[model samples]
Target: MDSSKELIKTVDLLLEISSLLMVSGANTNRVNLSIDRFASALHCNTSCFISHKTIVMTVYEDNSTLSCTRVKNIPPYAINFSIISAISKASWTAVEEDWNIDQIAKEIEAIKKQKRYPKLVVLIAVSLAGAGFCNIFSGDYINMGVAFASTFIGLLIFQLTHREGYNVYLRIFSASLIASVLASLGIVFKLGANPETALATSILFLVPGVALINSFTDFLDNNIINGLVRYTTGLMTVLAIALGLFIAMLLFQ
Candidate 1:
């Protein structure tokens, strides 16, 4: 069978790629484009229907007698531009070559297995980011120090929840609450010039900025349902953060 015909016969593979692409945070537009790029690369006629949580794809051969359809259920994933970029590169490479289904599958598997930054570096980066935000807000040196410690410890606690992969909202609340307790130590002991800055900036690292930006981008791209859903999720996270801080203040005061 021709390579192009092989692609049509493997509609499930394309759907899998599309689902994985979205799971890496490409947004709806990028996901649609990449899926079309893969289909067109094989010289096949394709139809794709994608929502926030699912992807449905159909590929058809020229004879119209040969076709396949696939449905993929996508789970929520944290934003990771590295994975998204790698997938885009792989799809483009496939477009430029007579790539088979196994080759494409192998490429994805390799990307998934690629090593990430060291955990120590990641933890330090999170701490520095919180301190940086506090400094940007004109926090005093003492406040920045408190923010740094709180963010570092809070992120460590958050990573524990992520490792277990359960109760996402609960994890957020717990992490923020723990961080708030540490941050509010400044106010409790009357140590920092502006302890409120320390408390607020510590959890800044945990904000769902990627989700907020993507949701607005989706709204502008006319993906309203998904846009609203993502925006709502982010909002709930903000509320969780607030609740965590409120409880911390009540006890610490």
Candidate 2:
């Protein structure tokens, strides 16, 4: 194939990889690095500006005015560490094997097809984590049970809303409100020694830990603009949770 077509292909591959990384919880630096690695393997040069919602990338060969540029809007954000890790591994493999565009594309498609844990398993594990948090806060078994139940129901609501393509913050708010309200029932029934702790802990599953952590990671890596964007997103998510919890408390009071 001609260099012009090859450059276009290279840019498309870079955008696809970068978009997957961005939406799958990778920090901006990692996305940049992965793009660089893929370009190196393809014998191309690239520059890109990545943001929370889009990537603008350019590709060309050395000493050539022939180039291609594209702007791709990123997909919705979600935490999928498996995709991040797999793509990072694939980037390295591309470098070591001196992969062509077709090979790398196949690898990426395979990574995308990876299976996630079952919904039932995820719900149970997350609920158990909430219960564990309640125990850490000095709650007894009864409070832990309350936490578990609330987390499970809340996560179920979140999954349903997510499947329906509702706005992300709305899904989080609905989940938090439902979970907190359910936890408050323990207080009303006097069912646990530390009912308040259960109520406080049940919504812990909705905390934007990955986003907040990635925000700080980007800041430390000198990706200030992306860091600030992620930080603001995390802040908004926290506010949504807080508002939901506040409404739940008002109901109980």
Candidate 3:
């Protein structure tokens, strides 16, 4: 009974560590360090650590050790689920001496094999377009439609690049460029009513408002490094959009 209780406590510790690592966006090496620290904090002789640049975790216990390596590149959501499963298995092992880690791992494998979230990109695109439309000044249907279309195209570009696994920087650049070009075309050709207002609203989707907010939140949380990084990234995103628009105007003239 005491052994079972200890197992449950260890599992709880694992869950806490996993949650912290996930929130911090720690890489595999850092995750391992976190696990080690957590084990020390819990006064547990058992330790779990990950390999550098790999998703493999080596868990050392009193008399035995085990290694669990993810075979494929798992998404963040899947990783979260895996962490939960690991915690559950650890809890179960507390009550059962013959608990099969391999079987538990297989269960995690099965869960991962399930279809991932489809239409996530599509949803994000729709959200961007909607945001752009909302930012527009006019209430007329035609102006709104134009603004929505322009932003939709920009979002579509971002989604396409995202599907190809492009980095965040590239994705931001591509989205900004597309939005600027579309808005510029609308303005230069007089394609829509109140083109200036429409274009301004449409390009608002590419703004870094969320990033700035998060940066401030990070600062409030005393994460200076992360706050600065997020703030800089947000600034860069805004600048990229502005630069794209500027270039488009110069060429359109």
lDDT top scorer: 2
Residue-wise C-alpha lDDT for candidate 1, range 96-170, written one tens digit per residue: 996867787788789888777887899999898998888888888888999999999999988888999868788
lDDT of 1 at 150: 97
- lDDT at position 169, candidate 2: 93
All candidates: TM-score: 0.92, 0.97, 0.55
Estimate candidate 3's alpha-carbon lDDT, on a 0 to 1 scale.
Answer: 0.55
Candidate 2 per-residue C-alpha lDDT over 1-253 given as tens digits, one digit per residue, 9 for 90 to 100: 4878878877888899999999999999899999899999988888899999999999988887899999999988878999999998998999998988999989998998999999999999999999999999999999999999999999999999989999999999999999999999999999878899999999999999988999999999999999999999999999999999999999999
Query: Candidate 3's error at 197, in angstroms?
Result: 2.3
Which sections of candidate 3 miss by over 4 Å? 1-117, 120-136
User: Which residue runs of candidate 1 sit more than 4 Å off their true CA positions?
Assistant: 1-9
**Global lDDT of each candidate:** 0.84, 0.93, 0.55
Between the candidate structures 1 and 3, which one is better when assessed by lDDT? 1
Candidate achieving the largest TM-score: 2
* lDDT for residue 234 in candidate 1, whole number 0-100: 91
Better of 1 and 2 by lDDT: 2
Model 1: clashing residue pairs? none
